[model samples]
Target: MTADEPTILATSAGYERGKYGIFDMRPGPIHHFAAELANAGEDAKFCFLHQAVGDPENWIGATYAAFAKTNYRASHLQLFPMPNHEDIRTHLLDQDVIWVNGGSVANLCAIWRVHGLDEILYEAWQAGVVLGGVSAGSICWHVGGSTDSYGPELRAFTDGLGWLPYSNGVHYDGEEQRRPMMHKLIGDGTLPDGYATDDGAGLVYRGTRMVEAVADREGPLAYELRRAADGSVTETPLPTRVLKYQ
Candidate 1:
């Protein structure tokens, strides 16, 4: 795979439940996404890195159950804390997809750095692995993002893997404080102008260029926020193609 062939699928929020109750996982669309990454049913290995969860094992079972419904048959859904069964570099290189789990972005970054998974992940990405995840998982790929990782208050998080040139904002509609905080950061030059996605929507990128915005639900939009010359942030809605779950 070439440098320009790298695929990235990132979502603001997934089909998981909070206090509101359970949301359908929409396995069809997710399977389709996995199939695309797997290159039309060819065998692919999926690695689920849950360092963000703090305790990686906490969500491993749920993650496995979630992806088991997907078309990608070969998956390595394990926690970061598990004893390495193989060399980390070799393990990452063998994966066709690297799915990150959401939790604390700050903590995740720090952990990955300490374990050298950051560099390993970058290598995998460069070698054409599809890097993806939700929430903090999505946020870590870009230069920065608006996050509540530190505490209850959402703030600008400017340290990311920088695989993508710009920043990002997730849960655009799901979280009330997210929109305003992202806008303020971009407008005030605290955060770089970048992309934002509502829950259920995702932005697909081929390398650093955005190829498309996709959603599993109706009315969920993705936006490109840019700081204009006048120091105001302008939000341009990117057309999103709704993925059929059937």
Candidate 2:
């Protein structure tokens, strides 16, 4: 279900507790919104990328079990010692949606570069395969962002996929250290003007241009940060389209 135009949906949210699953987790409303954004059919081909978490096999199994209750054909691409798929590009481009899980984004980017997943994903993005994810997954698509990849302390991350020109901030409301770090990074010119999303919310981008902000529930929204002339950053709350939980 590739679109004619490229798309990326960055968010601070991920899977939530499910009433039906071996792992008791299911795709949230924001996840469904990603499927709709990709124009996925009833039986969607969803590929999960968990490079950030070292492609843990336990979560991979859980992802399969969770999707089994629904119609999505769940699959995962692992890059621990070697790539799980022979042709990584083909596997990614074939999916209706590629959902990335959260972890150390610095490690994710490093491993992706080693395996050439970065360029492969770039091709997938150009081919209109819906590319989106939460946390580390969210930050990977932007020019830079605040990441705790090094440790508990947050720092500016400049090396990203750069599919989106602006920086990105994830877990805006959930983490006390997130918002202020993003502000400092943008204000100091370490990162460009960017967007930040509170938990359960995301930003939709079409060909590098933002289309809208989407949330799975109320109160969780997105923010646009711009560095003002006097080394200050303005955070403007954007209108959010809340999705009804199915």
Candidate 3:
């Protein structure tokens, strides 16, 4: 219930795996990312949860392993692959950080509700766990998550973990087809209003404070989607390349 009690770092883009240099055990911005979580005072244990089917071989596991080698001193990193409903439990109370990977939001939500993972995550966040995720991982935290590439006729469910009241649309700038697809879906009454993010960008919320941070060392953009007074959907660009080492 206090400000800055838990600092969350959500990345819109997938975790970069190829020698990012941040997790290289050297002094730099990327190293600072690892340090931020590694240097957390007492009561912090990294819980890297991998989502989706191919995550074990994907960038998610690689990213976590890299972080573990350079930062996370904890021994165990939880791995949850596809159909994660049965794995959902209230045991997260013992963790100080929870990181989800990018994957199918529909499947994630389905399994989340079936096994009550949503409530567990909420409890973890309130308990001071630094909660975060990557692409699909970040979008699912919002309300009425975006339904762009998943098909117009097949709409994913609206109810999410509800970490935030608003919904988010990831890869707004990088995905050329997502913007128009989102507008069409919203106009057709398939999806509610939400925000969008660019590749290598982030929309982080630490407690009640929200800040936009870019992941890559170069160009990456973000956007916020809202309904106009005239009932029209609009996309507003967000500031990018604006964060520094802590």
Candidate 4:
């Protein structure tokens, strides 16, 4: 089950490919931590959404394998082939936690809006289902963020589900363009005051209010960004508590 109120874990953190298997995307310790955050009990219900990456088979197999050993009863919602579930809304709303994969934020948003998942997801969040992921998954919950979905060069994208009521910057430290672009977006009023996360780090929001920042690994951190009166941006570092697997 999820928390009593809406909980969002927006981050630039997710599975990593392992050399052992061709499609083994290892869900790191952060996965366990996220599950606990959702307050999932003995048998957790987890759902994965891959619309951001076109629901590639290789990635799907990798993600399924990632949850194979866990107590979670894992499933996925696919959009490419006419939806795998008969009632997408019911299936998602029943989930305790929903993890999304990163790919094309623009395309993901467009498709979700077309299929009415935007509303469905919002309903799930209101019901206290923990929703989150990396990159595109992270951006989808915010008002907007920097995206390279169009090309190699990053662009400001404001089309988001807006569950958190702020813009989000994913991979803030890993990508060189993310910081400056997000700064410009906030400065020019293209986006409102927001948060940014380095790789492996995330922002924890409870009911549209930021509660804390968390990281799977050391060194990575999250930031709060705001625009000054002179049209400049100021970033304040948020204390991050590193999470470990229980």
Candidate 5:
């Protein structure tokens, strides 16, 4: 009921696999993300709103369809193509879960703020509705914003939705070259603690409580971050890397 309440599911940004080559109709990381939504509950509905570079319509159907197969009465917030004009904040009052897909983080944040969806989701989380996104979805949750994925010149404009206290750079370990960039970004002293997740990996924030940080692939990656007090950064190996090299 209040905006200050905790979020239901705080997630990292990245891609997840789908079933049946249907891309949308099958379950993957997302299904495993939230066990609360596992059982049939009050006719729960999950919305996959898209606003990045690609056509919203192309992804809307598959993601919505994939989520719907959860054996719950899953349905899109709006059946029409993405970038829907529907009042998502208001809709959250009625739904159980919301999944904003990945794409352009800038575009997604712009649209989210334009329609005040951020405020709505914050309110919904207090009411116990699960809130999550894939790529941009997870990035928007960070406090420093998702900087690595974007171009260098765009760093000034890379401010995220400020949902979480720390910033994140996804898919870091996937590309070895990203290490230098991450080190540079976090070392610049602009970003606080930076978290890097491999392709099949994720960090879950449950209303500010980190329940788990998991990696589906070999192991997780590593994290490079600076503490706020002394501004000293610590680079910790993620689950995957910790198991591999350590």
Candidate 6:
């Protein structure tokens, strides 16, 4: 990835009511986010990857509705369990912005590997495509992160695509178990010292380094968790710029 490559915007939360919900009309920072992503790409070919949903059409319509509000056009491809599908690679490579939807992080990673999408996405990023997402979408870009993909109990997921060399934890304020688990994991050396974001907040990484923290809400924050020499965990709050709705 070049220094001038667009940063990956990973959000902890946004408008995700799924099908039957309005995408472009939903409140908050999504429309602005989508428009910015579309503008950066120069081409508005927005592609959605919803492998975590396990259903091809489950969230595609809603995703399309959301992107339609911007200058871009949207499309979704179902890759889980469909290896023989034609045009899969073409669609992925052609996307100016690839938005990954949230779901089971483990399951999404597993399927992406099976279809070799992990490598494809990395190459796409290297080619200047803007990659962004929420929750599991956010987690997939890190080296690891805390997740509840296996069961109700949250655990460390260390098999991310590794585009970013740190662990990640989403929904920092929305979920009760997330904060404590992220702290314990980094403190115990089970996971690398990494970043965490509150709902509606986003961490922006230019290449592999985090450059800024942003939010849709006024008070929501993002943080960096590090382990001290004495094995205690420290949370450093990052400066955040709250985005205005367009």
Q: Extract clashing residue pairs from model 2.
A: none
Candidate 3 ranges with C-alpha deviation above 4 Å: 1-3, 6-8, 19-44, 54-64, 74-91, 147-157, 187-189, 206-214, 244-246
Per-candidate clashes come to 0, 0, 2, 0, 5, 0
Pairwise lDDT winner, candidates 2 and 6:
2
Which parts of model 6 have CA positions greater than 4 angstroms off? 1-3, 16-31, 34-38, 41-43, 68-70, 81-85
List TM-scores for all candidates, in order.
0.88, 0.96, 0.73, 0.96, 0.74, 0.88
Q: Please write out the lDDT profile of model 1 over residues 1-246, one tens digit for every residue.
A: 222377788886465444533222333364356447646453456777777876544366555665565555444534355635457788777777777768899988888888778898888777887888889999999988998888999988999988888779999999999998998988888888899999888989887898899987788999999998888889999999888755
Q: Which residue segments of model 5 deviate by more than 4 Å?
A: 1-5, 8-25, 35-44, 77-87, 146-158, 221-224, 227-232, 238-246
Score candidate 2 by lDDT.
Answer: 0.88
lDDT of 3 by residue, 55-76 (tens): 4554444554655544444423
Error of 4 at 176 (Å): 0.8
lDDT of 4 at 1: 76
Q: For candidate 4, write residues 181-206 as lDDT tens digits.
A: 99999999999999999999988888
- Number of clashing residue pairs, candidate 6: 0
Q: What does candidate 2's lDDT look like per residue over 1-246, in tens digits?
A: 876589998998777776754378877787777777778865778899989999888889888876777887888999887888998888888988899999999998999999888898888888878888999999999987999999999988999988799999999999999989998999999999989999999999999999999888889999999999998999999999998867
Error of 5 at 125 (Å): 2.0
Comparison by TM-score, 2 against 3, better one: 2
List lDDT for all candidates, in order.
0.76, 0.88, 0.58, 0.88, 0.55, 0.78
User: How well does candidate 6 score on lDDT at residue 144?
Assistant: 81
Per-residue lDDT over 1-246 for candidate 6, one digit per residue giving the tens place of the 0 to 100 score: 122575688888567355555543342375356446545432367677787768456366666666555555667777655643486667677767777878888899988888788888888787767788889999999988899888898999999988899989899999999999999999889889899999989988888889889998788899999999888999998998898764
TM-score of 6: 0.88
Predicted candidate 5 versus true structure: per-residue lDDT over 69-107, tens digit per residue: 455445444322453446655666666567666666776
